[model samples]
Target chain A: MYITWMLAEGHTYKQMLPTTPGVFMGEMIVVTVVGADKPGIVAAISSVLAEAKANIVDISMTVLRGFFSMIMVVDISGAVTDLTDLRDRLERKGDEVGVKVMVLHEDVFRYMQKI
Target chain B: MTKYDASELAEIIEMLSFQHLDIRAVTMGINITGALRYDDLGEGVREIVEKHARGLRDAVKEVSSKLGVQIVTKRVAVTPVSVLLDAKAGDLNEAVRLGVSVAEALDSAAADLGVDYVGGYAAFVESGYSLGDRGVMESIPEALSSTERVTAMVNAASTLSGINMDAVYEMGSIVKETANLTGGRGCTRLGVFANAPEGTPFVPGAYHGRGEEDPVINVAVSGPGVIENVVRSLEDADLRTLHDAMKRAAFKVTRLGELVGREVANRLGVKFGSVDLSLAPSPAVGDSVADVLRAMGVEEPGAPGSVLALAVLTDAVKKGGAMATSSVGGLSGAFIPVSEDLGMAEAVRKGSLTLSSLEAMAAVCSTGLDMIVLPGDVEEHVIAAIIGDVMALGIVLDKSLGVRLIPVPGAREGDEVDFGGLLGKAPVMPVGRFSSKALVMRGGVVPPTVSRLMKG
Candidate 1:
């Protein structure tokens, strides 16, 4: 089924729903993780997203100047928790994994980089 | 998903986390003209301002958190109170009393609504003063001293209208009286301007002019530290290359400001006014325009090459910012407030930056003679002459300039006076030894520039 959401600009966007109960739709977010390379870093981050039902649409990982860095574009439409809660959970997970995580809305990138 | 390179993402993060990239102010310009229809002027102003500004702080917070950007201050600017009081007050005393009442209303509403400041307690008397203008001038010391969040400004000169030496002379004493009342702290919230723009987001000079929407969102972008970082990154780069780098950094910063401003306006259901590109600096280290000048190869802020360096920096910022957003207004240049900038205060302490040099630098930059502390015993005519000099520049150059001077009561030259918080602290700078009393005493009007004769 198609579901419509009111965007910040007052425009309506339609998304196809999975017909599963309690699944909702929301905005896109960018999660950036940076720190030293270590074991189970990806697992720890992805596990928190999995718990919140946030889908990782795209991700790129690299090491610059001997420090590990990862960028993930997340679709939080179906997340069980709000952006703030999810950010806190991911930050806590990043702390446990010895990294720094930043959560920002996707529009910050689109508006700043495009045109 | 929207496509952005990982490197671009990293640059954005670095700018925000380390370079002090943020919106300095999101000022909502609200028209309170309709308040005149009510019988009780103060109550009417309170109602209208409260209705408009109620959601400003919350809306700003919401957008700041959603975008992960820091919005430092949420403020409101209303229509000039003098315009509202023109027909309301019958005598000068009534005008002063009514002005204070309205100021109190604005102050209480701002306090309750969580707005940091409310501007537009002002009068525009470039040519001459109406009863309302005189009233606002007389009440300024009292209004500002009594209210915590109210700011006042006077536009006594403009390019087309010439300089109003009478108003300028009056403002000098108004500033002094305000200093006497508030230990010079009240003067910090006051400004005297030439060719004051209508859509400024900065405090003490912001106002909702006649052609503006009833409610609009105007944003001021501050990134002196970000520009300084870009300048420092280029080691031994030529001036041309330095300009290009600063321009590129300014483009990114302006883009961020426009984005945040539009989002906040959209949420508040108000028209987006403009994005000011002024590189406003704070008291914090690394966030100073003077430091940017120093990084540009000048030994100090007021060194020999300082004017050239400042002109280049201001031009590059304007060019890049113009490309980023079409709706640019306000004082879109670098603010060199001595007390508000650590580097500038340091320059004064080191005896490298004098008032004469600062005046020369003001001819090239924006916001003339801002946040400068003068000796308490200095004559009023000296302040008038200083303001008149800056006004002359504005008219001749056809640009916007403002003077915000604080004459600290009982403070001597070279004495450090701390206003604390974002107002910062600076040592009182010495003025000219000789008197300009005769020059200022011949008060009438300085004629408009010869450029006014030119036709389009």
Candidate 2:
């Protein structure tokens, strides 16, 4: 069963997992967006992920000193596409929205941040 | 919960985008000992290397794309070519011919496999030379000159076995001969080592030693720019604070290597070897190790406090890297190769980084006197003395060190020569006019250090 969630900003992964246990069982990718604050940034990025059927397990966004930053934890195991194609789509979407988007496997953050 | 803040994510992004942080090399160590069983040595070696290195580049690319981290180079390291020559070579001429043929095969296979460099044209003769060792020593110049993408190393000293001055003396002439043969480019592909590590991923020294897995993936991580950025951000911070910051940065950088190495190995179905903690620098502006020293308040790389600064940096990197991965096996320290580092080359041109100071720094750093260019007419014995000095340090201090000296043909002191691409460019530094011929000529072996006899 493919499930997609648009969790509220600042919602932690732990908070969402219990609500829909085993629904987030997929390869998690970290998508970071950074650029000047602008309207509709979230809509544009979410559209691209929606087309690929990737689930947004968690998201956090903030604007500091006129610069916008957002981190999206996505589950791509149920997506129809691989990481490379998803990255290409997200990058093209980034170009359209004037933000620098980076799509990285969640393991990079886990390995570096944890131990 | 694995919690990560916005700042941590931002830091990783900045490192990848601006700090030039990347896995420097993913070298696959292939055991080629079985090649000697075949009648045709060169063909046997070619088939083995081809079979092992077939999918290495694709594997690296796939992992790099999946992780979104840049992998700069992919390489292969095979068993020492000298091992095959041991059974095949009947004399010096036969050794030279066989070595060149094998080197050509390695080069062709590397090109076909899309590998950057193929290492392990090597001989280990710390105490003395075997017939094959002598043959390899004699064949180095011709082998290096005849082949591109083939790197060679000779281990002439070790803590337990002492220094082999005979091979050291011969290597001097080999460097000169290679310089004359390849217009000094071949010398860049050769190194003389003391305590050369078995699983080093760095070229000119990487070789698959005995007891290693059939084919293993060993990663060398590059992060001088990352460390330099850390030091810069901590403006006016105390040395201890700066060290802590650099160590944290190293932890993250090494984690990247570990992730990339494991993924690449998993995809290739090979064992993951080790992540060399060495902060390998490139010719890029911000990526230089000298710049890292300068960022840490050293006026120039060879200035008075340079050694102390380098010591702190090397120690911090080792500490942080050791914590990050249990598999740390190569020359796990900082590298300050002159030509390959923009700031180090600039320091030489400014007359601030002298060869003498580089040797002193080598005592505390990884490798020794790397990619240093000398005047063409410099005597062979003087080169021998330079190598002997570093060899002594490696033995006495019981560390891994190596020398890659290039005596460029028709080039004089202060004259700049470019070796293109990753080899970079450098000015021909002046050597002592006084001869060390007398000392190097009276060579047999420097006895093992007293530390070797100490109770374990």
DockQ of each: 0.26, 0.38
List the candidate 2 regions with Cα displacement exceeding 4 Å: A1-25, A61-67
TM-score of chain B of each: 0.99, 0.98
- What's the number of clashes in each of the models? 1, 0
Candidate 1 achieves a global lDDT of 0.88
**Candidate 1 TM-score, C-alpha based:** 0.93
Residues A16-101, candidate 2: write the lDDT tens digits: 45235433455888888888868878877877887787877767765532467888778787788889999999999999989988
Candidate 2 docking band: acceptable
Docking class of 1: acceptable
TM-score of each candidate structure, all chains considered together = 0.93, 0.94
lDDT of 2 at B380: 89
Model 1 regions lying over 4 Å from their true place: A1-26, A35-41, A61-68, A95-98
| lDDT: worst 10-residue window of model 2 chain B | B1-10
